[model samples]
Target: MKEITSTMAGTVLNILVNVGQDVSIGQEVIILESMKMEIPVESQISGKVRGIKMKIGDFVNEGDVLIVLE
Candidate 1:
């Protein structure tokens, strides 16, 4: 299993992948809003999305686990 973590503190703006969805490396899986900027959070590895730990409008801190892949 692979864990995807947030790179910065921000509010989750969108979630692009659903559970069991296949994702490629570098694919944008989530959009985050911080400092008035839209930041795309991408997948680091290719795999199926196993779980989502955050939801849209949720506030997250840097290094918080956002998704799990397998």
Candidate 2:
């Protein structure tokens, strides 16, 4: 299994993948808003999305797991 984590503290602006969806390495999985800037979170490994740890509008910190994959 693999985890997709937030790169910085921010509010989740969008979730780009759903559970059971296949994802590739470097694929944009989530968008975060911080300091009025939109930052994209990408998957570090290719796999099927197993879970989403946060939803839109949720606040997340740097290093927090946002998505789980297997």
Candidate 3:
């Protein structure tokens, strides 16, 4: 399994994929709101989404795990 992690501290603005969804590398998975700016989190591997670790409006810190792919 591969872990998708946040690159910076932010609030989870949106989740674009659900569990069991197939995703490719570089695809947008989630959107983050930090410092009054929006940033997108991308999928790091091409695989089926196994787990979603956070929810919308959840606060995420840098290096926090967001998703799992298998």
Identify the leading candidate in terms of TM-score. 2
C-alpha TM-scores of all predictions: 0.96, 0.97, 0.96
Q: RMSD to the native, candidate 1?
A: 0.6
Model 3 lDDT tens row, 1-70: 8999998999999999999999999999999999999999988789999999999999999999999999
TM-score of 3: 0.96
**For model 2, how does the per-residue alpha-carbon lDDT over 1-70 read when each residue is reduced to its tens digit?**
7898889999999999999999999899999999999999988899999999989999999999999999
Question: All candidates: CA RMSD in angstroms?
Answer: 0.6, 0.6, 0.6
Q: Give the local distance difference test score of model 1.
A: 0.95
Worst 10 residues of 3 by lDDT: 41-50
lDDT of model 2 at position 6:
88
Task: Show model 2 residue runs off by greater than 4 Å.
Answer: none
